[model samples]
Target: MIRLAGLAVAPWLLWPLLGAFIGLMPAPAGADDTASSPATLLPAPVAPVPPLLDRQQVDAAIGRLDGIVDAAMAKTAIPGVAVAVVYKDEILYAKGFGLREVGQPEPVDMDTVFLLASVSKPITSTILARLVGDKLFDWDDPVRGHDPSFALSDPYVTENATFADLLSHRSGLNTGAGDLLEDLGFDRETILSRLDQQPLDPFRSTYHYSNYGYTAGAVAAAKAAGEPFEDIAERVLFEPLGMSRSSYRHTDYLGHANRARIHVRVGDPAERRWEARYDRMPDAQAPAGGASGSISDLARYLRLQLRDGSFEGEPIVDAGALATTHLPHIAGRLPADPTERAGFYGLGWNVGYDDLGRVTLGHSGAFVLGTSTAILLLPGEELGIAAITNGEPIGVPEAIGSTFMDIAQHGEQTVDWLSFIGGFFAHEFAVDPAGPDYAEPPASAEPPRADDAYAGTYDNSYYGPLVVETEGGALSMKLGPADAPKRFPLTPYDGDVFTFEPIGENAAPLSAAQFRTGDDGGIASVTLEFYDRTGLGTFTRN
Candidate 1:
């Protein structure tokens, strides 16, 4: 049977499969507007429902939870981990393991807050669902109706795209459209405003996971509710569910005393070790990844999900509105083998069906700098598990959740989940070796022109101004808003081609900056390879 892994935020490696899973094929050509409705998007079960594991069987799996987590921690060496399992309305299991940070004595506990990363998407969807229940907005409502600032390059899409379209990654903004801007220190408003500069795919028919696209949908909901997105989330979901430790603001997470420090892997690959760092500040994409909460808080949230948006017997959101978040809305991955089942993405979750024909709702969040989190819900069994770690993603969280689900469903893990899922994460995040080695110039590399000849101020409508200037003895480029431009020192590669290491979450080790001369033999423009994903990286000399 086909199984699924978690959703990753990395644009180049968004969807990674673990097993076979079916996704609804996009509507045929000239289909009606209703073709992408939730009713029409849900995939048929692959097989008849087998007899589910009995309560005793599930409890037995829970009994082995400590051992499973312990084993996973030992294998991954994740600095900190907190896991919660919910069955029916009860938190069947909740625990923490390892130190909160390397060389620190503070042990991770149930209350230790960690960044949720992309897992925040699912939480954001929950907030929208509650808003939908209040009649503040509908999933199908055009985002522009609420927030006129939300727009895309395609006029038709900007005017017609619905909240559902954005949440399901079908608005056609290319994968990670605004992420580069976010990495370049752009604010949320600036990123959203510049989305019109991004190229589009085929509107609703294409699935391209975009963090800013998802954030745009949340922003529209906040506008409709007449409040900030964070406030709406608190009022509609967090506060109602009693998740006091949960918050979408990065500042709140910083103020918490028991929060886990985010850590990244460093040093040699074979001998890599975790180091605490505060480099990833996700406030710009708050709705997409800026969330921090304890496992105890997530357990409460999970209970509401399994209970159809009810908290402690009280209905927090309409069941129908909440259910829509779990239904397949678009095909996430098209398998190379036609016979293989494809994967689907729901409103904010990765939707798949397990071997038992039970619907599985899952999402994996990662900040390449640090933090990895995963959540898996079996709505059919009313069972779910959430795992969070304060370390760079190496599949610790996905492995933990997948292992728990496997044990619960089949009485034992069917595979070495850590190795299987971790291998995929490793491959996805692995550095590509095919690119030009900028560090080693060609033997006959031609010398660049005089520093003054290539130094000048260039401009691009989308990225603003980029200043190439001669530093002490070398060339450097500064780009961003006028007040706070990021600077990168350029190294001569070959002829007019110079290279610099781009920084931030989406940066590559090295990127080539090629300068082209006009008819007058004066440098006319420079194209930054790293920022050219959507054809917006070229800066023409002013």
Candidate 2:
């Protein structure tokens, strides 16, 4: 799992995109070449090689889905889940389980919309693939050619990075760069404009999963199409595929009548109580993590992917162009142990090879505020499954998809996948107990300076101006855009160090604001620990 600004991105979610199947070695020379030999000697008719899983095996797997989903929900206590499985050209199963909300009477059905989270990455790639087929722009074309405003800290990278480079997360931006700005109420344009301020890793040689970096590529693609990404998605892919219920706009999701309300676990960690919260708004990075749709709508998408960019006997996107989106463009995860397999990332999907050397494409999506979604495709078998859950990620969707794939290929699950995956999620989301207990201050702690001394305007190029003001004898800090700054009331932890509870999706529970003094014994700078991921959280006192 990747942790940025205290937000945990599921490890599986970090994997993305697809690639071509590993081909068989060619037959020895002089085997059967009718063209080189006499016309009378014809080669024997060859039988078609069977698929990895037969119809009977697929049917048997579909039969066990109900039990798999039922047991997962019962154990996790998630509010709702919608799952759809597509095999060949048919929808093998599409169903929804549990309530739309824990306390609501409306039950989740096949049409119930849920946020797709990072699963939107593949959908974005699909739309771009359509544009590529139309000759709008090639995947390797430099992004600046399409959008003049696009840039990174490194001028060379800014001018040379391609759509494929950014989409595969190899442009070298720090992991989750620009995400904190989004959490701080910064809009898309503001966030995009500020990405040049972020530090890079090692140009195209580094793989750091960045949402805004991916969004930058999508935004550039939209510019090349001369339309917003949402409109392009509908015009190029959604409408053509008859996915009327799918949308990249957060407003459309909110307007949906049967949408699953996002639910997060509240109360003690052991208690596991859930509460519905309408807080996450991912429109800023829509191309990377903002998509909402139903299982029925996603089933069609799986069919298109399995059929190589074709849907319902019609080619919506060019097969060659779409295949580019699945080819491994960069190594995403290197195995820590010899037994584990290395993972690769393509345009917007995770590419991996199974034991049989068959290509497996998958990506997991999650919002800690409450949604979890996953899609896994076995292209060799023409089988794929998509699952969306309306609850905080506890590995429910991934587990469901894993269980289904196991049953499809092996005829039975090899292990308790839910427990195995859920344990990782639990550990990732667990609060770190190493930090200081802000609620209890040490009796020997030194007192803070006068409120007026700390009350001043501070400036940071990356995060903008931060204003510390004295309010009713207490100090408070405001940071973000001037119009809508987020205010955090400061509570003194020690001399010159105050603690405040950070807010928003990427916020840490408690962050310290340490005031630095100059030779004059006056505040010179303030350092915010939570906003310092790239070492740019310090603000000079103005």
Candidate 3:
């Protein structure tokens, strides 16, 4: 893990197996080709040819999965899990394990809802393909074609940016650019408006994992479809796929049942305890990571993709367009490894292969305090597995997906997957929440000035404005728009620098807060940093 601004940056933390799958990247060759040159694409996807298993074999596999899951839960103290596996055209198995909420007897079920996190990217990609099939806009069309105001700090790339560029994460923006605004309660349109102010990377020269880029793509798609993003998804994707329980809006989950509660294990191993989190993500970035659904609902989605964009024999999007979605749009950098080639970033999915040279595609989604989701699609074996857990991730979903693929592809005897994969992600199990490596504010510091001294609003060009107020003799900060936006408690650490106490486990772990002083010795600006990346912005006193 790379440390950025005193925080451990694990951009690849969620994509632990991506490097191993680099060998399975597929080539494309088909009609309805949307690429600038289809001939340059990889060969067509290989159809799944794994041997079919008898009910006895299937039952045993399910039993093994149950044992692995149960062991993982007990060892990690994970609260609950929902898993669904599809082989060929059949729902091979779907089951829930453990409790939806720790200490509660209710078991997680097929319909239990978990946040899809970045897993929403692939769904967003499919939605883009559906719109392209409808002739809403060409995949390569300039992003500004749909939203004339769309832009980056660099005018050249901004003028040349395309929908595919945004979706493929080649838009030259830093990873998670414009995310601070989302975390601060800014709405989608506002986030889009402030995007130009965020920092950029080398133009199309690196694989910067970005959620804001997808959010921008969604904004453009919304413009092209002449409808809200959620509405477009509902009409074009969910309604047709029969994803009755899936929704991008938080309001839709208000009274929903069997919803997974976000749980965090705090304290040391001896005294660690699971705690529920109440923090929520901003709805504006729904296109990026704001999706919630069950394993059953996601199984239908996987089935659609497995059938090459057809749903129940009806064409949702043309096969060629779907194929184009899976093709790598840009080179993705991975550490130099003798075993795997440099990876590539596709539209939403990471395009690559397994060691056996079989095509593999997948994505992982992580909710900071709650759940982790993994979806692996092995087109070569007509197999797909989606695993979601209600507790903090301990490689449950990835291990399950990998084990399912191994069973279908290799037909091997059951392996101790819990111990095998858990060993790879041991740091996850050994997370010391109270360790100094965390971004918590130091307890030995006091403010250099009175609390009211720093009370005021600060502004940024691209991230919008932030308000710092003194409430109850303590300093608090709020960002963007909200009825009563959540506040971060500020504790002074060094001269003119402070740290914020996180509100909840899911809330952004803001590390250091520095107040730039004017020549007059007054606070002139403020800057904040998070574990995910660098300092957000220099918010000047308004």
Model 3 agreement with the true structure over 218-275: per-residue lDDT tens digits: 8888899999888988998899988988888977755577787777778886987877
Report the CA-based lDDT of candidate 1 relative to the real structure. Answer: 0.81
Best by TM-score: 1
Residue 469 CA error for candidate 3 (Å)?
4.4
Q: Give per-residue CA lDDT, model 2, range 182-291, as digits (tens).
A: 98889999999999999899976678888999999999999999999999999988898999999999999999999899999888868977789655899999999999
**Alpha-carbon TM-score of each model against the true structure:** 0.92, 0.91, 0.85
Rank list by TM-score: 1, 2, 3
Quote model 2's TM-score.
0.91
1 against 3, candidate with superior TM-score: 1
Candidate 1 lDDT at 48 equals 33
